[model samples]
Target: MQPWTDRTTPRPALAALLTDVVPANRRTLILGPHAPQLIESVLAHSSDVTILVRSVSDAQQLGEDFGPCLQVIAGALDGLQTPPYDVIIASDGLDRLLGYDSADLSWTARLDAVAALATPDAVVVLGLENEFSLLNLLDSRPPHERHGDDEWRPLHDDPTRPVSVDQFRTALPWQAEVYADFASRTYVRADVASAARPGELPTRLATAAVDQTDVPLLSPAHEGLDTAARAGLLASVPTGWLAIIGAQPTHDIYTESAHTVLTATQTPTGWHLTTTPATTSDTSDTASDTTGAAGELLVFDPGVVPSTISSGVSVESVLFRLAAAEDVPGFRKLAADLGDWVTDSRVVLRWDDVVYDGESFSHGVSGWVAQETVAKEDLLAAAWARFHGRLIGQHRRHPWPPWMVGDDLVSAWLGMSGVEAPEPTPATSPDTLPVASEQVAKGKQIAQTLDDLLGITNELADLRTVLAEAEAAKHELFEMKGHVYGLERTLGFRNKAMKTRENRIRELRGQLQKMTAAHDRIRDSRTYAVSRVIFHAAQVRKPKVVARKLVRKFRKR
Candidate 1:
């Protein structure tokens, strides 16, 4: 197989646009490389179709697919000469039509050559990729197409190439209608005024295109799209413009929803959109105010559900908006109503899953059912519980104090959601932590999720250290307690000895006092006084002195 270049891949939305624009049973010419699906779509309407390709292998493959119906020419556009046909399609811009053998042609020269191939009344279709596209700015990968091996002369280097939507329209020879193409082709096919109306279909479709882009961007494309919409510039942010020369396309905007591509045609009463059944769905579908009435956008299959033109702002978007604005009262009022709605409806837990245009609340496009039966109260609690983590983690600003976070904040959110929040468990540090505990959702995206897992791993490691420290501290405390008990026993024995010594000293003092009183009474008696005076007169005698000494010794005893 030849390496495909400048191939028009089958886009269902783009196909619908092609079918509506291209007429039946006409002579057609498709230049450069186009996907088999696109060729088949062209053949479905054309009588005699000719496909011109620079790849010889592709030409051979086409010959086999359509033996006689398709006339395949395998050469550069400059080499092959062709008569004018009723319709001409060059989906890939002028650059891809040039081959190795052909001389380098300016964009102006190439346009002139393509014009020469068409008849006076020929309907021409062309695709011009805008240089200032978000994809071009966001794409971080190395060269694949823009300045790759195939593109000898890069489209950017060409001074004559059209840059903007207006420039692209002016570049076309005929008065062509230009459309801003994204994930779905032909989202903005009407005047700027009509597309830029209150309906958010263009913004949603554009942002959906951003989400579907398969490349890493500088920043989140969703955020960028939202910024663009708010600035009133979404109508002109084109990845590429599909310009049609002869035929004016019938429809205004073609957008895709849950399972189907919907055509939004404005009517007298209001706009008509498709709807799906109110069942539990998994993926969250992005919605617009123009959705078949704020929350009532989804339907089973092809059916035009009429919706009035009103401010059908999604409750989810509104809540987020309120949170961003730090409007606690506004957020509370809406969140309470949302909780009530979720409680009543066949529940999809996300706030974004429901829509409210101020008057009533209904289901938005995307939905899913719970795996096991869950109470509506639990659904409301768990969703906000999850959102609570996102609020703090995403650094969402709120009027609540800094201390009120995590579970405390979750309780507050649940209260606002109109559910009586469960009372908080009082805080206490556990003596020991288990090696592992079940982990619930933390509202972390991929990068932060990796960090969170790393953080958990680090905490687990830290927990091991903590356990070791605690074990050591416990042993030390046990030893200290034993030492204190021993000290108390020793103090008791010392106290008992001191009390015994005090009692003996008190008894000895009482005996001394009684002896002193008896001696005083004897000295005061009259007979004792006379004997004392006689003993004093005979004090010189040795025998009396000896007796006196004996008496004194007896009294001391």
Candidate 2:
């Protein structure tokens, strides 16, 4: 790997633009064919770096192990537990990402899959061959004649025939759009130059062009630069452009191999960009002002704005709209439940006159009335009696008069009953004695003869006493209830009258105060007006009299 240096004048300018654009210490993901020299140049300037490389063997050979990153998929992205990576470089990885039949991944599906793996704020850059470029046209030669690693190298071995750029363009519009939308800076093929200067050409092509191989490029973030001499001018750029340095003979525009570099600059409107040649091998620093600072570029891509456009329409709104358009029975029922209905007097009048009178009065007047109305009334009375029986059934289920077993029958009839668990019975006391005498024996015999009779007599007496007590209690309760009702009515009436009186008093007091204040104001105004008038009249008389007296005195003198 080589550090970035300026061998040509334009090289320094290009280096400066890149340096200004790339962020210092930020990681950049690079994709596509090898550009090791370019990688060296970028690393020389950037402060910190990480790289994701596709050439697993090369990664392993460099003593770098992927651990579980490439393999253990818990689901699709299982092995990602490897430390968080900063940059991912895929040289010739797009075909794989797009699911070349070998791997069977579609571009759209792969894009979606990778997006799920990436940070929401992560910057994603895709680089593809500019199918429209002049070099891409030249690289379509037969396999043996073409560059050893040409895109279709494995397909054909014909040494003489070459495929034109136009033929390739016909098959690849999908790849074009992918590159355009994602690439911040797209590289069009540039003519190859000889040395480190402008417009110079190499004298001759090597006899074994296939044998002459370029250095295997470092990963996209380019952390392999150790020396300054091999560093390309393109490497002078600062980090964060996600530099896509594509300079493969497979795309063949140059007699000598050189690459193109794209550096994206962030702007409020969109990404501003700088593109540069990736071939200069000069290591000495020419212009400090031209190169970007170590830490200046932004690594995160904010992605598309409004998100709706890039992601397409949302399903939630469409579903909601469809639901709104549907006249669901659920909504109808809800509306009915919420609505209010009122039966009017007009409806009652119509029912009574039209249905009731018309059926009865049309027949012989008295007979019709007697037969239709009276019979209907009798029928209604029978129905009412049946309805009242249900009320009686309620009473039977739970007798109304309270029972002594601690049960409230009225509450039971009302269905407001509750059960109280019985208390445990106390053990019978043992300390007791029995007494007997001649009189006791006579009493026992008397009780034996009168047992059932005494019970009947006692029951009758109890019933009478209960009835009388109940009547007296009812009368007392009625009187008390009446007293309470009268008290409530009297209190309510007094409260209302008192409030009215208080309001009237307040109004009268307000009026009296206003009248007194007005009377005082009127008296003061009248007195002041009269005083002013008298004073003015006195002044006028004095002025006239004084003038006449002065004149008379002067005449006498």
Candidate 3:
């Protein structure tokens, strides 16, 4: 109502329903303001398309986008005055239109309003959420709250007012074909009659989750529910249910998907059961002329009765009932009445030597029967061997660490077997053993030999330890020897330097002696005496001249 802007891409289930049920030339009326993309897709096939919206704003937006080409009604479904439509698609909007909190409006009244707008022969498709879905079981919150719809208001103050499958079915004017939708209700799988049949429900519901790209919508705790469903559990509980109103039931049983089809048709002899792959041309063929070569068919006797197996019935009980029927006519009659008991009753049995000629088989039996035929002794022996083999295989695959061998391994093996393990025995010393008189001499000899061997072993270990220490000491000595060689080279360099200094000193001393000798020789020579006298005379003459000149000058003055 607040200008619905969340345009979810049209789910595949809705798309498939639209394509399968809606005609290209028929006038289609969409009861809710759906995604724009969905509207565009509808326009490609049908020329006359009208969408009903709750708000004027939504109508205005749609009108602006499509102009006059598409008609947008700006009112609720109850107030709309529109011509009868050939196809009407309401994607779970009826509940909202009726108002969840509106106590005055009944579902019947709301359905009547929708019926008024649809032609008598119109194909009406309605999508509704199952109140008893797996998602609801895990969470008590309403869908609007879970989906984070801030504007959502409960129809009533009570939280348990959601529309259920039974309520939805009762509101419908005609019988409808219901399907379970998965992947947030995007993909739909047929809710076949096998689901209604006892043992067959598991097979019918055992289909894989609808192919989806989104992460599964199931809680982690409920994750295994799908596998259980495939194994023939949860046939009654589906995520959601999609009801196709105005469609006639053609097949005796519906399959989860179009690909797997089961059909039962009446013939002159009896009812013929046939399983076939759905052909693109004809999807609703319950009976085909082909033999077992193309598809297998089982002919049932006309007097056979059909009975529903309770979900609580066990396989053993059913087998017991089957065996009892071998002699009792009444039991046989009852078993005959049980339609598809083997498949629908959820009884799992392994079969041996099973063959199919597209009709019946030869020497086919359940695995339980084969197991029963094996002798108890042989079975026990085989089981024991298998257990050991499994243990050996585990050991080979992931052997225990060295520390876990012997005691730890034995303890683990005992624990796995649910046995209380005893304490491990402590090793005994040789001295603790008692010696008898007769064997004392022999025992002493043996003891002496063992002691000697042990002493030798201890000595060998000590020798090895000494050898390791010696190796380390030898390495240190080698390092010391290298250090000593380096010191020697340094000392030799210093001695060479000292010798050169001594040689230089000797040369200097020799030179000094020669110079002194030369000096003495020159001083004692006649030439040296003459030269010295000349030098002294020059010196005395210069000063006497100066004195004479000074005396002559002073006298003149």
Best by lDDT: 1
Query: lDDT per residue, candidate 3, 1-557, as tens digits?
Result: 55443244434324434555566777888876566655665776677889886656777899999987788876665667778998787765465452222344555666778888888888787766555655455453455555534224234433433355555566687677765554332232344322322222232222223222222233321233444454543433555556667654343323312222333332343233333433322222222321122222122121222222222322222323343344344333432322122221111121111222223322111111221133322222222222223233222223345565433443343333233344444447855432222212222232223222212122222233356668979999999999999999999999999999999999999999999999999999999999998898777848878789999999999
User: Could you tell me the lDDT of residue 531 within candidate 1?
Assistant: 94
In candidate 3, where is summed lDDT lowest over 10 consecutive residues? 344-353
lDDT of each: 0.61, 0.29, 0.46
Question: Clashes in candidate 1: how many?
Answer: 8
Q: Per-residue lDDT of 1-557 in model 1, one digit per residue for the tens? A: 15544434445556556777888998999987766766777889999999988877778889999889899988887876878888988866676787877888877788888899888888888877677776666555555544555444454478888877777777778888877776443366735413442225455556655555555454445555666667665645657777888888766666545434555555553344543321112112322222333233122222322343332544545766788888988888877776666653333354433446677865443333332345566566556654555455334466778777655566567677766744345445675322111011221122132222112122222233355567979998999899988988898988888888788778888888888898888889998899998888677567777889999999999
Instruction: Report the Cα RMSD per candidate.
Output: 16.2, 43.9, 30.3
Model 2 is weakest, by summed lDDT over 10 consecutive residues, at 362-371
TM-score of 1: 0.63
Model 1 score (lDDT): 0.61
TM-score of 3: 0.40
Per-residue CA lDDT of candidate 2, range 138-222, in tens?
2334435543322321332322211222222233222211111111112212211111111011101111111122212112111
Error of 1 at 174 (Å): 1.4
What C-alpha lDDT, on a 0 to 100 scale, does residue 552 get in candidate 1?
98
Clashes of 3: 13
Model 1 lDDT at residue 366: 33
